[model samples]
Target: MIALHDAVGRLSAALGGSPAAKLAASALVEADALGLPRFGIAMLDEWAADAAPVPETAGAQAVSWLDCSSCFAPLAVAGTTLDLAGTARQSGIAAVFLRGVRGFGRLVPFVRHLADTGLVGIAGAEGPPFVAPHGGTRPVIGTNPFALAMGRGSERVVIDIASSSATMADIKTARMTDAPLPDGIALDGAGRPTRVAADVAALLPRGGQIGSLLGLTVELLAGVAGAGRGDAKGRGVFILAFDPAAAGEGIDWQGKLAALKSDWTDGGGYWPRGGALAAGTMLDGDFAQRLDTHLARMAGQAGC
Candidate 1:
């Protein structure tokens, strides 16, 4: 196991000392800590090399639109979502329609950041077409994921899931480890079911038509966010945040939440949340070695 701070420091050094680098480093480490290592520091160089795009912002009422011109920097995407927490606080509710970006990692961290601020956050993203519609062959939809976070501080609930049976990152990790995917998770170019991750041309939706419907929902939401027709090289992201205190529920929401927690616990259900790694968290030997090798290569390239 590799210490969290050690991983962050190495990633930061490899990416440089820019503020954006630090943000990406921290988010990537959080990904590993949250048990989503497929989206973690493994792709540090890929993320760091992608420059942040400039978005044309258009704001009206409690909503805003950010039309980025090209590919996204993970840093800019996360930074923008963090900025929206303040907007939600002021407006009680706020939303942003994002388009013309790609390669942002997991949506969990973004919404989790909002939930930490005592706001309810909802986010969905449509990625490159990597999944097929129900009962159809060929790629037509992304491994779209939706995420929602609610509650305050340590007491929170978070839901983040992809509509596809498997995510692109999962495939990448499978390939990296030379591991075969579970049966029925993906299809080859001819749309036949296959377990070999390397031959995966597209993914199957979770629960057949039901998950297809969710993917359709994400696509339509992206369309509403101003994405264009045809193959989507970039991605569309939807983010909405609201201050729960503004809901006019006429009750102590936090206290009620605590009561609900008690009941949930008594029922053997635990609160669902993602968090930073414990101080003792460490990376395994293989991943730690990978990090060291990548960092050394980067340093050598820079003649350091």
Candidate 2:
């Protein structure tokens, strides 16, 4: 398994990043090291694609208070990710509309942090239009990813997903495995179905037509809602945090959720980390080697 510190050092040196960037990068690598993620690729591509731009602070116009707050941040997503959690702590429920942000990375880690801070998080983001439309060939909408996380006593559960049938990262990873695509996962450059990952040019939607609908819906919520002035920079995410105690359920609300989870498991079975832990992470040598080479290249570019 890749040590978390090593991953952080490599990513930080590669990006010349902030603490938040380093933390997010480390999580991305760890997730990939564990397995091919159901969500997508690590944020390293976004970071290494270009040197990080100077962050644009959220001016007063950034905050718009209605039932919650919306922040238009044309900058990094990490600080705002934490800021929303704190806002929830004070506001009972807070929404952060992060516009023009990049390197959204993994939602699980972000929401897990919010959960640890005693909050429930709902988040989504829009990235470059890498997926072709449901009935069309050319790319149009983003993968449209979302995540939900909640705290349960001393435990936390995070669920993350991308609306595409398979993410761009999935195709790239599949290339490494030399595996054929599933029945309806991707389309080739010629707009025909292809099983070979390397030949695939665009991804299809998840759940067939349903994923198509949901993908657009996600963009509406996370992308259009907090529409930014500039580019997505490969990542534009929005997150909302809610304080469960705001419902006047008291501090034991997490206990209630945890108990419900136990009941669900007792009834039959559920895939959650309530009392169990994952089998130890088994690092893939090829993945680690390729990842290291890419990071080393970025670091060299950064003069690290």
Candidate 3:
């Protein structure tokens, strides 16, 4: 296992000491600690490319937007979410939209952060086309991930799911390990069911029509938010947060939720809760080797 501190230092060195680099490095580590390695250090190269040419931002009041065509998505999204958390606390609810951004890894960490602060959080993003629409063979929708988290304190229900039958990360990971893809989740270039990850042309939508609609919803949200941007490719994301304290004495949400958790657990059902980031965690040996290779490659390129 690679030490957590060692991993962070390597990533930071490869990324340089910019503020964005620091954030991205920390986020990747956090993702791994949360057991979401798909969004972890494996994406260092992608994040490095997106971390440049800082994004343009514009907003006022409860609604704001970001133009992240050439920006580091993790940094942009994280900064925006943090800002909106404060807004939601003061105004009950707040939302921010981002367009032209690339993959920003998992949304769980961001929403879970809000949940930790006693706010209900929701986030969704549409990426490059990889999933087919309902009853269609052609790839037309992104994985279109959606995540939500809500609870009083440490006991929060967090859900993060791809609207598609599978995520691009799943395909990439399978290909890396030379493993067969799961049946029924993906199609080949000819749109035929395929088990070979290398042949994957498109993923099926999750839950059939329901997942298709969810992907479509993300597309529309991103479309409207990035309406005027020439670089907009319908790749957009939005984060929303709501503070219960702004309710001014309504239902006891905290108490009700606590009771619900008890009832569900007592019935032998596990809660879909978020886990805290384990800062002292270690990475799998294979994954750590891969990261070291990436760092070495980057360093060699820098010397060229």
Candidate 4:
């Protein structure tokens, strides 16, 4: 993990401290920690190979406009605004807009950064319209996503979701791994529901019009800030952060939430799909012993 952080740092140095690069690196590491194979080890080689120069603009306030220069500026501006909001928690509410940027790899890291700072964070990004509204055959709106992060006890709870039934990257990853995708995610080129990842021509909304409403809400949050339209022209991102203490009286909010969670779990509930697996549970002791025994063989394979 330390080596991975160092590698990401080196990449960021080449990108002129752009927030997009830093957030991407952090998201990659967090995904690795969560053992998500597609977003974890598989991406390291791609990141290393895709170290092309990313153009950036002069630094400005959160409400200021930025010239992305056809780079991943939406994420960069979002990161900067998130960092500013973290500091602004000392005051009251902190809302910022990041405009005139384009392209964003993944947006979860910006929300996670605010959560890591002991603040509740919500971020929304509006990109090209890639998905059609439910019951429609043609593309009508972007697969705009909203990400929320809040400090939960010593750990953080991060939820990144797209109003669409699935993200384009999710479909692509399912295709690459030959994995069965969740139902109601995509449609065939002929506008019929399909399971084959390759046949996915457009995405579906999360819960029909309700999801569309949420998508529009995200659009408005990302739009009115003077950012570009949600069409294919340019992209925009809006971020908001607030400290929990700012709302309630002086109390250990984390502890209270943890207690509530404990009570709810003890009360019993349906098992989540895939069963509950604690962190690091996949690395069994027997597997670790075998891995140690085969260290020499692993080294030889590396040389080969």
| Error in Å for residue 66 of model 1 | 2.2
Tens digits of per-residue lDDT for model 3, 1-304 = 8887778777866777655456567777777766777788766565543245554345435777777766666666667777788888877898888887765777877887788788999988877788998888879868878889998454579987778988777898899999988778998888888999999999999998999999888767755564412344326888889988776677788888889889999999988865554557777887788788878877776666
What is each predicted model's overall lDDT from 0 to 1?
0.74, 0.64, 0.76, 0.60
Instruction: Find the candidate with the highest lDDT and give its number.
Output: 3
* Candidate 4: clashing residue pairs, number: 0
Q: How do all the candidates rank in terms of TM-score, highest first?
A: 3, 1, 2, 4
lDDT per residue as tens, model 2, 168-221 = 877888999998889788888998888999998888888777888877777877
Query: For each candidate, how many residue pairs have backbone atoms clashing (under 3 Å)?
Result: 4, 2, 0, 0
Model 4 misplaced stretches (Cα beyond 4 Å): 16-24, 28-75, 152-155, 170-183, 188-192, 195-200, 224-226, 231-233, 248-252, 267-304
TM-score of 3: 0.78
Error of model 4, residue 228, in angstroms: 3.5
* Model 1 misplaced stretches (Cα beyond 4 Å): 6-23, 34-37, 47-61, 69-72, 169-183, 188-200, 223-233, 268-270, 284-304
Q: Judged by TM-score relative to the true structure, which candidate is superior, 2 or 4?
A: 2
TM-score of each: 0.77, 0.70, 0.78, 0.65
Select the stronger candidate by TM-score from 1 and 3. Answer: 3
lDDT for model 1:
0.74
Put down candidate 4 lDDT per residue, 1-304, tens digits, no spaces: 2344553454454334566556655554444445553443233332222322343324423333444434445235545655556454766456565555555445566666677677777878776776777687766567888888776433356667788988787889889988877788778888888788988888888998878778778777776564656435456677777778876776887877666556656889421211112333333354234333333343444355
